[model samples]
Target: MTITCQEILKTHEHLWQEATVHPFLDGCKQGTITPEQFNTWLVQDYQFVVEFTRMLARILSVAPRHHFDVLLGGLTALKDELNWFQVKAAERNLSLDVSKQRTCEEYSQFLESFARTPYAVQATGLWAVELAYNQGWQLPGHIPEPYTEFADRWGNLGFTDYVKLLEQQADEMLGNASPDIQKEAEETVITVAQFEKAFWQMAFNAT
Candidate 1:
């Protein structure tokens, strides 16, 4: 049985909704989130990105030749993301070094486990992860001032287009994968969605 990324998303659409729609994002949209809340989440996300960058590198090492350009470009963006975080942190008087919260550590471990998975599995999983952020921030429509940058960075036209490319890549990879690989990829999306949801709650609770 062949599975496309769309089918995987459709099958777990409820879980996807759970991960993407949350009070945290709602707060962001409403402009009710305090600087402390936002900053805490930003710091945690920076740490998450650090691990995410590592995962991207490991997955790229084993990625198919055709995937080289997209995956490599993703790494470059991630590098810029880290520097962006530092610049933002300095503006807020926030420190980049801090303890990883329970959810962040668990999420990191979850991402790490995918390192040895098949390329199809990793690519599909990566798509699910990015799509959550893309939709999560975009779904809210109008974001007020101050917080617009956060949503715009991930939800803007450029990022949305890039995510579509990722979707196409994952779908192409899964189309040629074994049934077992497809099955694992579906499961990987579910697991990643769970972490995404938890990470949002963790950030919200910090407020």
Candidate 2:
């Protein structure tokens, strides 16, 4: 079987399951996540988003000409995403100034290290991070009231399509990559998946 980028990612399905079905997400889906827990996640995630945007900018700087528009679209989306975080924080009386948790710090470092790497590896990392959230929240069943907004932000069709586009882009990049680049890209995916689990664990711990 010819292994594709998504197939390489799926090889770590166990880790993805641990990440997507985490207790934190379960709490969100049930509308039972405490304010403190939600705030912790929101604030830590805001920190991640800041780094994520930086990573996206770095990727944009190095992405191939063919991939420019799609990457730019993602960069544009991050601006609104940051605004949404701020708005939601204010509505919940939550301060976005909360310190970054250990997981967030580690994940930020991981993403930052890819700043000048091959675009294929960067795209793989991006796909892994976004897919983790999308798959986690887009699970079957209604998301309860308080968390519906959060779910929709990540799980909505627009975001779903965006992730799919990223996936396709990553696969295209990987298809022409050298063997070493392909190996590195798969490693990046697994590492990001592990980070996804740690991120969820950090949120659950705050509860």
Candidate 3:
């Protein structure tokens, strides 16, 4: 009985697609997003990464021993990623200390709640969240300037490869879990998709 993330993704097919290709990404591709709007994502997402990195560290601590190497790589990349976000924000004169918008705050709180879930749930949710960004930025059509570099940051081959690695690890975790844990993990993926969609929408709609 090998359960898979693909099964969960297919279970919520419409939501999976919507979460990854929402209007915000469409705006990004068309270069319709203003600098202020971009700042909303930059500031909020940097904050989200901080919490997400913490969650990855927690997930690493409890994940199966064989999964450590990949989780460690994720943690390391996040350290560099935090720095990358800082540099990008500074270059654009965006402040990173602003208050988290409602969606961002709720998402951060949600990530923290993973402390109570099984490793399967944590790992699967993490994979789903990353997949959304990878898909969103990798969308067809030219991404205008500044946004092009950001797109490359997440949508590039390297990042896509990394996300694939994560998907494999998460699926492996889910496959070996108990029936209850597997079901919880699948539900967690759906929750992550909902949050991903909201996070993107938050950026585009923020005043």
Candidate 4:
């Protein structure tokens, strides 16, 4: 499965497309989600997000110094999201329980393990995350009610803001990469799109 970065990206694409795009669009249309529900979702899902970011950070640590900066930038964005999460929690007057860590999906476990492996392996995982973050901005448009709590909570700022930054970093990295590495990163983007779908599926179906 880890034969080449391109192969891994291809492996991850289809599942990703299906899982994320539909429900996200639906949620945006319904606009019934409340700030409190959004907070509960974040609090329940926080561990997966943090772990996911950590895995991406580990992958960034392995890139060539120039390329490494892009990954580092992505990590910074992830941290920014955490800050947003904290602020949102405070806004809603919700207490984040440190003891009740969220359960991770199997795919999340795979990402954490991939981050601990050789550089190439970790890089593949990083690509998935980077690609997803970069491309996810396109889906929010599908959301219908812009004024509802769901829209206010998710449809407004955080995801798109983070995505633009992620895309810019990806563009920089792609522009600077050597031919071989560039090919790998391209493949990584495709893989990430697939993973994005899987992540959404995990979220939608989570108990």
Candidate 5:
């Protein structure tokens, strides 16, 4: 049986589960995560998002002409997301001036490595990163106060739909790719999943 890109991704669903259902997310859901830890995550994530926005722009630059609108939408969302992070950090008295944690830095490096890759590879990495967050917060349960906004930011139906669109775009791009490119895209997805897990663990441990 031929494996679709989505099916290839499903093979690594365990990593997604490990990332999204992590203890940190559990703490957010139950309001048990300490203020310091939450702040740490916010600061580190803000840094990551800054790099993430750059990554999006990089991808947008190389995106096929037909895919410009979708990629541009993502870039616009990142700009808005960055603004939200700044406002929320101020409201919570958390400084956004903090440095990126080791995990975040490494993830940024991983993203940078895709700078010159094919569209399929880039889309696969981007899709994996977004899907991890969408699935993580969309986990079935009542999201507690404070964290509710955070959950809605990434886990809402609108975002979920957006992710699905990106997934489809990736699959379509991969459809005509060479076998070697397809394998590279799969590796990118797996690496993204692992990085996502590490990112959450970094937040949980406040390391």
Candidate 6:
């Protein structure tokens, strides 16, 4: 079924809320993570994101012409995160290539599966990605001290623009959607969110 943008946003909101409870965030904020561990996590995250982005691009290919601008814009904004990942890799003296690092196998598999799947699956996959990335911005300020480091790292000035762009896209998609399209979008959002959380859980279990 074709998914609407609004449904995608709602599903993302739910996913972000769930992410707040993830142990990965807890571990980051708790300072339980060594630099090495953080590097490993970053590499795995990049691997997942790279594959997800390709999948999103494919889905965007078939997006409604009316919704195309916002959807593509959102995708473009997210590409900046790749630079962040590269920087993190440099700091850790690690390679950005997934094959080079001991990347999380489950996350890698999820990305590949999401990318290779039919366009019908794009809505769910994209929704999960949007929820996770955007939620990174909306997180509460009360994050534990250990995780606080990432607040600045992931929540930089440029990231604010990214958040605004994403929120705006979500608003536009939801606001302009027909009732039927909205429902489909929401379902996609929820499905994607489930995948988003599962991806992290997969990573956490990996460690």
Clashes of each: 0, 0, 0, 5, 0, 6
Candidate 2 Cα deviation (angstroms), residue 111 = 0.6
Residue-wise lDDT of candidate 3 within 1-207, one digit each (tens)? 868988888889999888888777777787787778878888999999999999998888898788888788888888999999999988988788888889998999999999899887888888888888888889755688868988877788888888888889888878789999998888888888889989988877745
Candidate 2 achieves a global lDDT of 0.86
10 residues in a row with least lDDT, candidate 3: 138-147
lDDT of 5: 0.85
In the range 40-82, model 1's lDDT, one tens digit per residue, is 7999999999999999999898987988898888899898889
Full-model lDDT for every candidate: 0.90, 0.86, 0.85, 0.54, 0.85, 0.57
Q: Per-residue alpha-carbon lDDT of model 5 for 1-207, expressed as tens digits?
A: 223567876787786678677888888988888888887888888999999899989998888888888888888899899999999999998878877888999999998998978988898888889988998888946688888898899999989988988888898888878888888888888888888888877866645
| TM of each candidate vs. truth | 0.96, 0.95, 0.95, 0.61, 0.95, 0.62
Model 6 steric clash pairs: 7-185, 7-186, 28-147, 29-146, 29-147, 31-146
Error of 5 at 107 (Å): 0.2
lDDT for each residue of candidate 4 in 155-178, tens digit (9 for 90 to 100):
445555644554554554455556
Give one digit per residue, the lDDT tens place, for model 6 in 72-179. 775775587677778768877888765523334554455556545444344444544554654553364445654455566555565556545545555555566566
Best by TM-score: 1
Name the runs in model 5 displaced over 4 angstroms: 1-3
Relative to the true structure, candidate 4 has a C-alpha RMSD (angstroms) of 5.9
Please identify model 6 stretches exceeding 4 Å from their true place.
Answer: 1-17, 99-125, 142-149, 152-191, 202-207
Instruction: Report each candidate's C-alpha RMSD, comma-separated, in the order given.
Output: 1.2, 1.5, 1.3, 5.9, 1.4, 5.2
Model 1 weakest lDDT span, ten residues long: 198-207
Runs off by more than 4 Å, candidate 4: 1-13, 34-37, 98-105, 140-198, 201-207
State the RMSD for candidate 1.
1.2
Of the two candidates 3 and 5, the one with more favorable lDDT, higher being better, is: 3
